[model samples]
Target: MTQQPIISLRDVGVRYKRAGSIFRKTQYYQALKSINLDIYPGETLGILGRNGAGKSTLLKVISGILKPDSGEIINRGASVSLLALQAGFDPNLSGRDNAVLSGMLQGYSRKEIESKLEEIQDFSELGDFFYEPVRTYSSGMRTRLGFSVSTTISPDVLLIDEVLSVGDKEFRKKAEQVIIQKIQSQQTIILVSHSEQQIIRLCERSIIL
Candidate 1:
């Protein structure tokens, strides 16, 4: 029996407008055009492209952060989360607080978030810094905390956008291992990456934007 798609997108297109100076007319760019895709349950799909090729834009649309300018998206009622570097965090909040906030934003209850706090803290390996304001954190520390929180929540549809490159070598290895485990457990994922090797290793199928 064939598997059903958890999300379906047809004739999708996204456009952006650049404001014009007094001397020039406004210009518009099409970020994505005539895109059609079906994301099946429990499949890892890699989206590959260079900078400004709409890979991130496509993920945002699927995650419901952006609406396509000219097409229909049918999400089969799956909960979705996007894990982009520095995307969902508040700089003034501590890592622990951010983790709680992130979980809540992903549809978890406050009690559930509180219960997972310890696990998220341990997985992030942020130590005492987990209680410190995120603004004081280095980029790598923020990445670790963000990755831990997002993975812990385990949304039905996870969207990752160029976040694998955020941390140090050791942390990157750990993050990659976690993602591999998720794939092994048959979690559905849409990954946007500029790294060709990473895509080939983690994805069963892929498309270039």
Candidate 2:
């Protein structure tokens, strides 16, 4: 039997207007144009594109963070999560508090999030810095916290946007291992990356935007 798509997008398009001063006219750009795609259960799809190619835009649309100006999206009521550096973080909150908040946003109870706090803390490896406010964190520290919190909850559909590009070699290896395990467990994923090798290795089907 053939598997059905968990999410369907048809004739999708997004538009953006460039910032302009009073003397300059604003120009509009089509971020995505007449795109049609379907994301199936337990399938890993890779999206390859250069800068400004709407790769991140596409993922954001699917994750419900951005609304397309045109076309329709049909999601089969699956829990969706987007894993992007600094995407869902608050600069005023500490790493620990942010983890709890992110979990709550993912539909987990506060009690459950608290129970997983230690695991999130350990994986992030922020140590005492985890207690400090996010404003005190470096870019790498923020990435670690965001990644750890997002991965703690296994969503039905996960969208990853260039998050692997951050962190040190050791952390990147650990992150790749985690992704490998998720793939082994047949988790549905949509990954946007500029690395063609990564796309080839992790995805059975891919598209270039």
Candidate 3:
């Protein structure tokens, strides 16, 4: 028997309003055009598309970052986590502070964040700078810290939005290992990647957007 889908998108449509020029008329841009899809438990769903193909938009919709204009999103039995770790980070805050903040956003308590604080710090490897402001971090350092803190609290549904390009080889390796272990443990993962090799290695089924 086939397993039931943990996430179902029925006749989903996402529309965005375009920036109207002084000389031109305003318009509503269709991001996702009457799309329908399902994500099953214990499966990795890979999403591929060219730029502006609504891959990120789809992720935002499922992650509850964006609301669709039409259709219903039925998410059953799984908590979702997005790959955009810095989506709500404060640049003025220290890395350590951001870790706790991010944990809270992911539904973890302050005590829970404290418990895993050491692991997040160690994995990020930001050294003494971990106590410094986030604005001081390089893009790579920021990515490392963000990835470590975000993935530390595992979710039933993981959404990756082409963010692998933001980190170095070592951090990427660590992240990949964590995700691979999660996949083997039957967690649902939705990954958006332009790399075919990554898709083949990590996902069993893929949807081309």
Residue-level lDDT tens digits of model 1 in 1-209? 19889999999999998778889999999999999999999999999999999998898899999999999999999988887444469999999899988887777899998999999889899999999999999988888898888777678888888777768999988988888888888789888899999999899999998
Model 2, 27-117: lDDT tens digits are 8899999899999999999999999999988988998989999998889998787874444578899998898888887768999989999
TM-scores, all candidates, are: 0.91, 0.88, 0.90
Residue-level error in angstroms, candidate 1, position 57: 0.6
Which candidate wins on TM-score? 1
Between candidates 1 and 3, name the one with more favorable lDDT: 1
Query: Each prediction's Cα RMSD?
Result: 2.0, 2.4, 2.1
TM-score of candidate 1 on Cα atoms, chains taken together: 0.91
RMSD of 1: 2.0
Q: Sort the candidates on lDDT, descending order.
A: 1, 2, 3
Which residue runs does candidate 3 get wrong by more than 4 Å? 20-25
**In candidate 3, what are the lDDT values of residues 131-208, reduced to their tens digit?**
999999999899888888877867889898886666888778887887788778877888999887888888989988
- Identify the runs in model 1 with alpha carbons over 4 angstroms from their true place: 20-25
Estimate the lDDT of model 2: 0.87
